[model samples]
Target: MLEQHATELLRHTVEETFPLAREVMTLDARQYTCPERFAQEKQQIFSRVPLVLAASCELRKPGDFKTVEVAGIPVLLVRNREGTVHALLNACTHRGAAVASGCGSAARFTCPYHGWTFAQDGDLVGIASSTDFGAVDKTALAMKRFPVTERAGLIWVILDPDSSHDPADMLGGIDELVAGFGFAGWNHIESRTMHGPNWKLTFDAHLEFYHVPVLHRETFGPERSNRAFYFSQGPHQRVVAPRGRPGDTAKDDLYALGRLPAADEPFDPLLVGEWILFPGASINTFYLNGQRGVLLSIVLPGPDVGTSTTTQTFLAETPPDEVTRAAMEELCTFLARVVGDEDLPTSALQQKALATGLLEHVRFGQNEGGLQHFHRWLDDLLKADDAELAALLAEPCPQR
Candidate 1:
């Protein structure tokens, strides 16, 4: 199946045939400006969906844990001695103080407020002065566990404890799409957070390369092609430039495929584009000093409608040497500047314009099918009830 997809891309390259939507699509500017709509999205989409929370390598060993907040919900992720990952509400049962903060390794956590101790599995094991605290069912007070699963070298967690939707089902086989990357064995180098405009606005810029030549003209535009081919399985999508297209960083290496036998074609070119795990995670491959690295960009809703936080996590296939490490740092800094100086500042300006109520809608061209599909899925999810959501995800995801 992977080879077939690669062959299809090669054929498109030779034919100059990139797919397009039926027509131009327009979205309401208010989708990025309205607080009520943002709140609804928080409830219906962000809270209910299985989000890409952390890379598998972040907690490669047992007893490793990390804490992150999603849509105002504090979550604690721990890898137990049994090699299983668990997601628990970070709040302590007694006074609701967060028992954990940041990432580190620990066998157990004790709430600072009253010394309520919880094991790696979230069992309430020790309570300060339990004899004086009175008899309470410890089992009933175990930290509330949310649905969590690790797949394709990433950690996925749903915020709702009672959600019927399975994280695997929600992914719709996207794990297979990225299985070639072998991300579980990767090593996380570093992570940093950057502020952006509305979450949707920040993510919209990633869905299509239509603005690459314009918005990223100084850096990527000169050598890259603006054209792209989008392939999707459910809400997850991969954006690829045709084989030998200048947009591909390895286009020179791919040109050899034209004369090479089909069986001899390399598989690396097929994985050379952006892979988006929906609601908001975009994974892109990069190379520095001849060492491969992946940049995982996770965008989560902020405290308000006008703000969003993006965590950029960089992972390398193997540990880097001093030279590669320096190159990686340079590359990371360059990307931060591109996003912070170019993309997000423009989005903030767009937000201000839309807030003025002067522009009624935003336009997406026929070529911008990715944005169309994303917004349509958002609409569908927003209107679905819990039961309907289960049924919706249960349907088989169509192949590209």
Candidate 2:
């Protein structure tokens, strides 16, 4: 979907690696904040990447469905009577109107525009006037469907007509990384969306642990050490930070910090794991033994400059013990606040600078290797010739 010229620029900008010790990384500023580049990314990144689009599980039973948008394309996710998940264009074939308005369970969808109806399986079950239409092939009029693949408890979709890559293949090392956390049995909890700044900025904020000690000082400052952050590579980049031990504090202050009973009660050490899928998907997992959870987020491009949306879904072990579920909910709420209240505002400010054109480039330090790897990957994607890009995009889906 990216323009030819912007792809060329992205290729040219990402050709060099900035060394961080023995690790080589690349950083490209234009790709992040440039309007033309952003447009190109919407087409190439969001459309071609299955991991960004297809991911779902049953909220209830058969006939359950949810509607979502990717990059700007409206999508309807439905579980048919057979319990197989299907991703279909949300638009009605009748007049291109969205068939379903919101997320809910439905036996069938009828277009408000013309009374054309579709079964839960996306088949055209009724035409307002079948006999009057005379020999119109209803089977051929089924809702346009996209490719959907389910893996590791998530459903992924590919929107591009020419996309030949499998979501699992593009996921590369992320498959094993996710397995390391035992995510297959995780249950869906809640999801929230935040709008501000570009999605890339939100992802950039998560790609490093350097900001943890500073940005999270009020909550985690006393317990965490900045130097403890470390990174590892797979299909994507991963950063792990060990939770810090709480320091001396008054009893009331301890209660306010969510640490009760006593300071010496020996609380579980926290582990924050982050995954940066090539392009712009970020998944952050937090472990606290009884309070394990994961946050899957995507930075989807809007229709203008300096704008993007962040959609986050929180999942935990389902059918959980009441206490564990309650605790996980509280923790997820807290994390969402940290992102909505703290990180987004800062990212918006960064977008302001990017739009003003006063800054041509942003710098990355040795500690931000994940950020560099993401940029380099983007460079490779944009620079690749159509054939090469197609090959990279069409890599076979990993076996579930």
lDDT of 1: 0.84
Each prediction's Cα lDDT score?
0.84, 0.63
Candidate 1, 317-349: lDDT as tens digits? 889999999889888888888888889899899
RMSD of each: 2.4, 9.9
- What are the runs in model 1 whose C-alpha is more than 4 Å off? 221-223, 243-266, 394-400
Which residue pairs come into collision in candidate 1?
A: none
* After superposition, candidate 2 runs with Cα above 4 Å error: 1-28, 53-55, 58-60, 131-135, 180-184, 227-235, 242-272, 287-291, 390-400
What alpha-carbon RMSD in Å does predicted model 2 have with respect to the real structure?
Answer: 9.9
Candidate 1 similarity to native, TM-score: 0.93
lDDT tens readout by residue for model 2, 216-298 = 88755644645323343432554543332344232222222442233464321122245665556777655444455678877
